[model samples]
Target: MIDATRPSAPPRRILVVDDDAGMRDSLEDLLSAAGWTVTTFGRAATALAKLPEVNPDVVLADVRMPGMSGLELLRELAKPEMPPVVLISAHGDIPMAVTAVQEGAYSFVEKPYEPHRLLSIVQHAADQFRMAADTKRLRARLASLSGLDRVLLGQTEEIRTLRQDVLDLAESEAPVLLVGETGTGKELVARALHDLGARPGGPFVAINCATLEQDRFEMEMFGAKDGPRGFLGEADRGSLFLDEICSCPERVQAKLLRAIETGTFNPVGADSGASSDFRLISASNLEPEKAVREGLLRADVFYRINTFVLRLPPLRQRLEDLPLLYSHFLDEFAAVYEIEPPQTSHEDMAALLAHDWPGNVRELRHVAERHVLAARRGRGSAAEAMSNDQQRSEFPGTLREAVAAFEREMVGRAIRAHSGRMDAAAEALGIGRRTLNEKIVKLGLDKDNWL
Candidate 1:
């Protein structure tokens, strides 16, 4: 068995074949320096005879040999139980090396190679092999948990379509862009994509572009010289979700574009680039086109991400799903608070549905959690009474009456603060002077008798 902990196993029992004794010693020495257990053979047959006993991780054989050419030796070790074989050849034997790799050889190295180059390739291959094993184990674990129980609550046609779109995109390798109001569960959509994707075994790395400083955003997304893996690298062989992508600076967007195009990037001060394989998913509350027009987002970057788009309908547009979402949040909070779920009165539901949820689902969830916790402590009825009283105090009996009352209060305050200067009041209230004049006239605020 290979000593897995070894910095490098001499390919476990590398079989290096060469007619020249000096060349064999050179190869063995080089591999040994890299922590590989080197076994040199003067002839290919000798190496073949010891293959079963050696159980090598890799076999390095010269393409041109005296008896039993490297091709022939490769054929013998090509069995399913055999380890990967790397063929070494001279400059003029390029064709043979190409053929070797094409025929299932792990890789080929030319003579007089740089030691670092060879080691890098070998390390990459080893890492890939290890990742393959890890992916298999992860798939089994994920398969057990793959079910609809994890699906977020919503059954409206719009939500059903969004869920279906998420499911479809998860199975593909295309980039996804989610556009919605804040708190509409963009991250949830990204996660659903990951769960449905092929590389579910890998990590789900997320970065909020809006949260990072403009100067530090690039390093945060791509990584700094000595910091933790950047969002891109962290999600290697996994999924990366960039939230509020429109907020990323132009420089950061350029770097992200390169990474997406080439599947490679470097740390802030790194001298060399590192390759990564990650699926990209981005979300933004602002419209990308409008952002580009406003010079907040780059147009080129927008095109790259305009691929598969998923738009989450705001709470107002999906009012039909409110009852289901409300129940889900209530149940969740009930579980957390260790209390019986509070029932929503018909009037309560009507009020909730009527209000424009400026904060979207997040606001609803917060309200539900508060209610559940309050109910657990027997303050639920008091909280409801207070809320009702507050609403009654602020709101009129009818919509038209409510609008008139709100308008009168706002106009009265503006007029008083500006000392009745309509122009100044208009400017202060962010309305055109003409609009303010009309409002004053329509509300009869200009009546001298009232003044």
Candidate 2:
């Protein structure tokens, strides 16, 4: 089995800086024979000047030198694009070699170089350097991309088709029903429909039926007595997005169907409420047909909202997008926290691609967030950290535990994404205000940590 812990790729290139003509020649001959492309320099200044052209994966320089010693050269190359530098030193220069290593030097080699050990160190250093370089490239690509290409990112056919559908459907006011499994970005698609639709300037009122208590469903959807208008009223001349529509009570679903048919709703304590001229958008984690068959949704209501159904592909269905999405999330979170983006090894990426990602994009997002935190702490590979999380999420001992675990993740993500604002997070998550507060206490979700 591949260890998947250490890098597997052979060293590609090295930059050798040594004053002695004989030493540089010997090192070049040795590394070249071992499948490495080598570039040598007699002075650190010359090597530093031509660093861009060289672009070596790793650097080998002698610690003791006349001017601009290897230690000084290491400091000069300490910028973001700097490759790993391994300092070659004699026994007497070991102290300086230690300091150089502490100051970002990859490693040190004593005067009598053991060829195998030197090669091993160089290989690891190049791996680290290449990893960082890859992250920079991903960031550059992400920054260059624009519009929906940036928002709904992926090169897969599924994603490409989905983006096209979003654009096509956005031009119309026809009711759109987004059907997909959880974590498949149904709400995102709903928002995109409204944002690109004709009434983009109008209000976008979203409601989550699953989070609304049965008793208050009518008041919440219609209007409260002697209070502000409900979500229906708020969505006048705009878009109203209903998430988890199948979760609403059957009686309310009938009224909702009427409201859609009449384009108006009556408020509690008011003889007549202002007419609502809003385009309806609905989403369900379950398939519309399945929800209707299971009696969770009204057949008439489902048929009405299914004027143009858009299905979101799950993460597993578009496995090719994992690397791109993972790197993109890393860049996003890093930028949010004002930190440098982290990189993953080929092995780590392979492990990620192999996983089924049952939680879909949401699961991947959480994993990316974890890797960013790991990078901030200067920790090891992300794959190791993900093992425990995978076990907890993928193989729970009980159904109740599994449900609780998922709620914690979802609620916590909502809070964090909304910067710890309960109202905002509740709205985003489709959880009721009181339910969200109760969830915070029961689940021990701290707003401070999310903030």
Candidate 3:
């Protein structure tokens, strides 16, 4: 049972290229004994042809070869991105081998080299190759996130700042505390911090403190001798995110403080403590300051974990970003349900904007999903279709009526404030002149009063 999310080490491979048939065989046998897949080529040219296919971790080539000398082969293969090559040379060719190394070969060995010494050199190259590949892979993965990841989704000032804050926080080893209301996607932000950080390949272990009972919280967090490895142990060398940290029991809080301070924790029923090295990321749905004032959270633990803090803005506070979020979720739901995305009229948009989204972005996404489902089922106009169960408790009884009322009031005010100047009114309302005029005509507002 392999953990697919865990990064596996790159396979070890050695390419032996020596025109001497006996020497090639000996090198192959030695590397194979060292538990590496070895491939032999009689000529440097033949090895070059197989380089891409085999992609060996290290290349061992003879200094004097038939088609291409080892130095010439090094010239062709010593790319910054390619696997390291170690040249084998006779004592007399020491100077040429040294030149090969200067050109980017990892190292060179004399003809009468010790087997152990040669193995040690190749092992070093293998380790270096693995590290380089891992770094490249991690960089590629992080770059992919900047394009399609959801953490940086909105166009609001708050979102832009949050993205930059995340990047800055990721550059350190300090603990992170995320504070926001429920459904504000705190976990997503935590993951972004982990994925973009130095240990992207490490595990991202998460647990909801609110879900853990007082008696089980310690065991779940710190692990036990006879039981499974707890979250802390599992997240070693990675990150551990505890959601609703305010809900952590008093007893567990003390232990957590010790773990972070000492980098070790006593597993349940174990006499000796175990090492626990991981980044700590915590989230609290409640106002952390309020919680501390109320004595629900320990002041000491809060200080330790709150080294870096980020607050995710509630969706209602960033209403201008509603359209982007709506479209994002609309496409997601459409693809998930295999249906066309439902069109949202200006009135429908106004209704959504008018409602107070207590569930934040999570609530908005559900509404988008339901709207698409209802439209696919041949329901009423998008407004009426979403008027029933999907309507927020804070919204008016009928979505269409509420939308009409909101539009008339807001548009009329914008028009009156601008003295019926369509261009000024449109700009004031954050809309285009054509849009404002259409709303004015549809709502049957009298322009004479402001004009």
Candidate 4:
């Protein structure tokens, strides 16, 4: 029986395999000197047999041997939970050693190896193994936390059913089409799907299709010579989320179709093609089938993405979630401002619920931020501010004019409340002090008469 309390042993078990008895002894001496529990086997088959008993942390195997070559030993140990294998080879065996690494060997060390180099490789392999294990544990924990029970935030039957669908689709790699209006949290659902899936460690890349100009759409999606690699390449081995999929131009749609089918794309101006192994999740405010019928989207592309559709209910449809979402946003903004969350009166909730939220959750978020800022500036309560909106009946001439008027009013209020303290006013408005000063100068609010 191996003594578990041996002082000369390494911190973990290390198996050394070499055909030559002298080489095996030398390796064992070096590894043992470095405080490892070293085990030596002259034959690769013997080492393979001992592996089940020892459960070594790392295997340092000589590539060329009499029987059961290092490559063969590596293949046998490729089973799950097996320790990482490091290949040792001669100068002439560099090509084979490279092949070994490609076949899942942790690393390759050329022989006759320097003791320090061998020790470095062993330490690195052990650390990488530990990191991989830790990441797996973290992913499992995240998945458990983000389970179906936790994902669906509301108790409504619609939300409950949607949550179940999300859970079911989380296990699949098929493309998902999330149809929702702007600010409906489509990206949030996409992330949940990726996290709950098998390849949680893979990257998640999102592209807002509506934000890209029509002429630049192809280069942005497929990558350009002067620009960084596009979203598709960036999301290799993970997921790519295309927001506002209907806005993807006809030319770009053609490239996307080819990429989805072949898992390959040639970067703009690149001669060679690169392959990506990733899942697709796309979102759009417009109905994809309707868009295809209108000729705004390709029929084939629509069919390809319509495999699994998840329609997010608009805020108006799910008014029950308003109170919870409102309170959540209140707490979020309050924490950022370092102020206690403002109290919401029952009348305020009623008014908020009654109003038609054309801007959806994004509008609600801004309203909450504005309310918090107003409350901080001694503007009574958020509800009182809403009641005052009825006093301003005359609408501004233009949209830009209306926005500027609202900005002036808010800035004026902040300035008066803070006794002309621009810094405090800027903080309340969530704008930089310099920016507030620039606006004040531009809008002719620098005079005391404005205050």
Candidate 5:
């Protein structure tokens, strides 16, 4: 079995920097024969110059050189981003090479070298360098990617169509209106519109309109003369996301509509001539049309910004995606907390899929985090609230009835976890596939729940 803790090593790159051309060629050929991609440089300066371009996993340099000595080259590449450097020299210079290793070199290798010993040292250095590089790359990816894609995970028909809609919307400059129930990832969709759009390089400024106090709404949207910068100015030449747009006060909505229509806005206390530039992206957990009819959202404002409307589907409507979404969150929290991800038992999976997920993807993520926390604290099973409160409230009349209910729930979860793969699900439940199928039938568990 492959150890999960071990990183898969990519092809190693070894940079050989030696002033002796014959020695450089010899080292390069030897390392290349050992399955490494080798680059030979006759001068340390040349190697340093090519460092960024070649990005060798390890550097093998002779201790003495004409201009830039191996020690000097090691110092130059001593920064965090540089790969490991191994210093080499003749027996007479072994002490100097050892001193170089003490300073920062990966290791010291003596001349009249043992081929296997040299290969072993270089291989270890390269593997360590590669693992560190992989970690850095993962962190970089986590920082740059907005994580909006995770919200729209799964290969279901609904997700496939939604992805296409998002791609189509990205090419347009029109204002986008996102509608979804609370926790259905409205904000994520709003971010996706801005991030995937043609103006992705521009800033993405977001504010929750519903949370803004009525008195401070204007000042927050439009900068005040003697107050802090407004979201409008901050989002100039970029996207301004107004979350819970339907919650914007009626009077403020009129002013916002004017700004969108005229491509200018009046800062709270600035001269009437002062104007702001920005693209608008709005979201509402409420149904936009209903909100307008109920006077919560201004009809005119809705018309002004509803050029492109997207509705995020609730989690319950996409039950088949539960396993994938659960795994995604599990992996995310595992990485964040630096712990091995906890496994979802048959019962735990059933509880996850059976829940309506009223809070949608956001709720599921929080639950997954809680599961991780619980597992770290030595609780191997799913947390009590893994199943919804309403569902758990039902009481079995007898102890035998309660035990049966528990068994049924676990079977259901196992099936769902495996996406109705009976053999795999049964194996996870430690039962033969035929026996599991019989139990499912006897328990009267709805196959639709897992399928």
Candidate 6:
């Protein structure tokens, strides 16, 4: 019996328990030949002792064992999360078998059961168990998506859709490319993918491609011949997250493409290829096609890594979640500082939602921290701490006017701080340089004045 919905998880394993050694051997041989890894114990007590270690998909046991009856084992393993228990009953034990099945036993097989029938039942039970486990795990992940350490918190349509996408891709192994504005939490999504996937137990190797020097990147990614292993080696059997992938030079991109295509790399000075099986998750804040056209990214590399491109929407696109997201950060900081979260006013909410958050969620996080700090330090209204000027009567003109003024000041300040270098300014403002350029044109800011 095949289950279409069963998760591709651990292999099937069966535990057999009976005082009869011959019966145990027969059951092991039968189950093993049927493609189930089988472990057999002579006693129900011994099987119980090895239960945690075996962690079988199904337990096949004799109902009338001497030390601990299979009925007792059924009671012991009756948790809703535990695997199904199948009891082997004798001809005279039909009534007891019925009672056992009523008391949470999966089903009972008579002593003279047909091998095919038994295998069928076992397969059905294992598939159901796997289905239950996957459902429980998915529900748990969704519930804890926004834990204190994780920041993917929002209820807006945009955020909700993004969160669902993350969950859908979490269990998959195909390469994924993240395209989102900086500060939209691409790294966070990568972390979530690593944590929720099949390789959670393995290392998560993360590096910002933008920060890697060309020659240095090859050495770090492919490793040294004998002395050191690179990020590719470290990520074996796990995940590798590359942020700002558009910044990777053509030379590095070629080597990266080869490594990803073949799952093997020749370390510096190595004689032969070494393999590292890692799930590749790359992120680029700039529009991917634009980056390729601009010669910032390799077209071949882009195509290879973009098996699934997930786009995370910027905060302004999901403004309906502003209050929830801001409150989350306020609560987060308050707990860290061991102070009560300050009460934000209607004016504070207005200030927050009035403007487009150019820097996205990362900007909101910073603002929220500042807002909390202001109250902690006895400063006035939290919203005014960043965007409000007393002489401006909250804002200078229309909603667009108010938002534009705040955005221009913020973007210009970031550019000025970086001496008008767009790359540095973009990094400082938690946005791509292309996005910053668009912002500059839209806001009508003179970069020379800022410099």
- What RMSD, rounded to one decimal, does every model reach? 16.6, 22.6, 14.1, 18.8, 19.8, 12.8
Worst 10 residues of 4 by lDDT: 385-394
The collision pairs in model 6 are: none
Tell me the TM-score of model 4: 0.53
Model 6: residues with Cα > 4 Å off, grouped in runs:
1-130, 141-150, 387-451
What's the distance in Å from true for residue 447, model 5?
Answer: 34
* lDDT (0 to 1) per candidate: 0.74, 0.81, 0.81, 0.78, 0.79, 0.82
Question: How many residue pairs clash per model?
Answer: 2, 0, 0, 3, 1, 0
lDDT of candidate 4 over 164-264, digit per residue (tens): 67767988999999987776678888888998887789998988775666566677777867677888888899999998777676677888999998999
- Candidate order (lDDT): 6, 3, 2, 5, 4, 1
lDDT of 5 by residue, 1-451 (tens): 8899998666788899988888887897889899998988989998889888988899999878889988899999887788999988874375686678777899988887889999999999988887888866754453246555678888889887876687667668889888776777777777777776667788899898756766888888877887777887788778889988866777788888888887677787777634556778888766778667655677889898899888888899998998999889989998999999998889988878777887788888888887888788878444454643334436776886687799898998888888977789889999875556445533545556666
TM-score, prediction 3? 0.55
Tell me the RMSD of model 4 versus the true structure: 18.8
Q: What is candidate 3's lDDT per residue for 421-447, written digit by digit as tens?
A: 778988998987655644553454556
Q: Per-residue alpha-carbon lDDT of model 2 for 1-451, expressed as tens digits?
A: 7798988765598999999999999999999998998999999999999999988999899988878998899999877678888999774375776798789887888888999999899989998888888766753443343145444689988788888788778788889988776778777677777777788789989887777766888889988668878989899989999988877777788888889999877787787655799999998776668557546678999889999988888888888888898889889888987789887899889889888876788878887888887788887555865675776667778987788778888998898898777789889988776567545544434456667
Pairs of residues clashing in candidate 1: 10-36, 10-37
Runs in model 4 deviating more than 4 A are 1-152, 225-227, 383-451
* Candidate 3 local distance difference test against the native: 0.81
What are the per-residue Cα lDDT tens digits for candidate 6 across 352-380? 88877767888788777777777788775
What value does the lDDT take at residue 148 in candidate 6?
16
What's the lDDT for candidate 2?
0.81
What C-alpha root-mean-square deviation, in Å, does candidate 6 show against the real structure? 12.8
The ten-residue window of minimal lDDT in model 3 covers: 143-152
Candidate with maximal lDDT: 6
